[model samples]
Target: MINKHVERANRVITVLFYLGSTLLFILLILSGSINHFPINKFYWLSANTSNIPGAPYDISRWTFWGLCAEKNDKNVCSNYLSPAYPISPKDNFDTTTNLPPSFVSNRSTYFYLTRFDFVFFWLGLIFTGVNTILYIFTFCSYSFTKVVWFLQILASVFTISAVCMQTAAVAMAKNAFKNYGDDVSIGPALMGISWAILFLTICLFFMTGGTFIKKGYKHHQNYVEMSKYKEDALKYQQYMNSTKPINTDNASNPTDPYSLPSTYDEGYQQQNAEKQQQQQPVDIIQKSAGVIQQNPKSSVKFFHFKKTKKIPHNDDGSV
Candidate 1:
């Protein structure tokens, strides 16, 4: 069975981690939406698109919104869009002129990859939020613990899928841009945060799973204790049932203590035999004493006393 103190401590730590992971996930979701201070710094891809015809900007950075480029020596981003937002350059520019051959040919790939990445990320965040709320209540009830465990599993899966998709989308885009002889790189902050979320989700999953194992072990221990108690109770009951009152109905032998149970144990029988042996010597001694009292001469011999001479008093008178 798991130690209560350890389990409680583990649960507190797990809840704290869940809260932290959810907070980070929310920040990631809000990155492109807010586009200010720290949020704007988190993007998926940054590349130089100046060589491509019909491209509006020389340097383009893609975020959850549309794109960001330098304006007035400061980064300016497009308006925010809904989740599962595609990242197709050809579609965005409304032209196929001078776009990278990979971007044009694999338009559907980029569209689905980026779209699925956002969709899963949003789903994961929602599930993780619910998980965080429910985790606190796990200490209150076993039912809550079970529910939270299940939710943790779901959240972990969603978060892992989202992270995997994000990595794939970002890496593929980076490679494509590099192949086109353009300078391109993935945003370190976004990818790093995404991976961190994944790691935390996995840790939470294992922690939740451990709860079930601990519960199972505790149940087994209870069962063992109950079985032992029942066995001891049964033995005591049998002992009580085995003992029967002496047949006092027959007044012939009312003082017999050994008659209560005819099935006397070996130890009791042995003690009784010893007592009879001890009394035998006492009986012989008593009988001998009675015989010695009946005969005075035998009593003197028995006690080893010497007889006195009758000549002593006569000699004293004559002298």
Candidate 2:
């Protein structure tokens, strides 16, 4: 049986992880760090040296929207166009160009920021969206847990890849500003927030990945046990088939020494009776012979008496 509380906790954690990642991607995309100067100090420096008439006093505080705002009759500098590439403003000011005047553009910085914004950010966003949908489906359908787990692992891989790309972008952006003036710092609050969120999301993905691995192991163990049981059942069936009952005709054969007849046939009974009858006369003759042997003296005396009687009759006649 599944542990309901553990399942619920996992679901909750996964949902939060996906949701947070999605929001972070949206924020990163909208923050406009890629189009503007990556560092606040550089932006401030560039804004101070610019020739725009009505630009904000503290351009460092301006967001992407404020920086991208169009020119209006009320303010001349309020409409400064966003640059096509990353630039740190120097002495030169050109109002006609789209780029902010008096700034040095760095091609390497532009490449990294562009990739981070267009590639890694979108990839993370797409992965997070798909993960959220899969999580919801998994939560609703408990039978497809294995499928859900596999898909989640894929999603986590994509998310981690995106995060790596973003980290590289941040590193490149920092490297681009390393040789700039003393007061210029590359650390931006938005970047810090983005990094923190990405770190948290990565941690959550690892946790979810571990959970899926454990669950997969358990599923494999159960499958192995079930297979073993099936094999045992098949072996028992074979044993029973091999040891079936002995043939009745073979067991009851009269020639078999182990055979025991339950009933005697008529022929067999008659044969026994005739044998007993033939033995009776031989038994009577043997008994008579034994009696004669035992009384031989008595038989001789009777014969002598008969002879004496006969001689007496003859002598009377002579006298």
List the candidates' TM-scores in order: 0.68, 0.51
lDDT of 2 by residue, 35-149 (tens): 4333222121122223333433322222222232212211123344343322322212323233331123544443444344445445556756766677676544544555555
lDDT of 2 at 8: 82
Instruction: Output candidate 1 Cα RMSD.
Output: 9.2
Note the clash tally of each candidate: 0, 6
- At residue 202, give the lDDT of candidate 1: 92
Query: In model 2, which regions exceed 4 Å deviation?
Result: 1-4, 32-106, 140-189, 246-319
Which pairs of residues collide in model 1?
none
lDDT of the candidates, in the order given: 0.76, 0.49
Model 1 — which ten-residue stretch has the worst lDDT?
Answer: 245-254
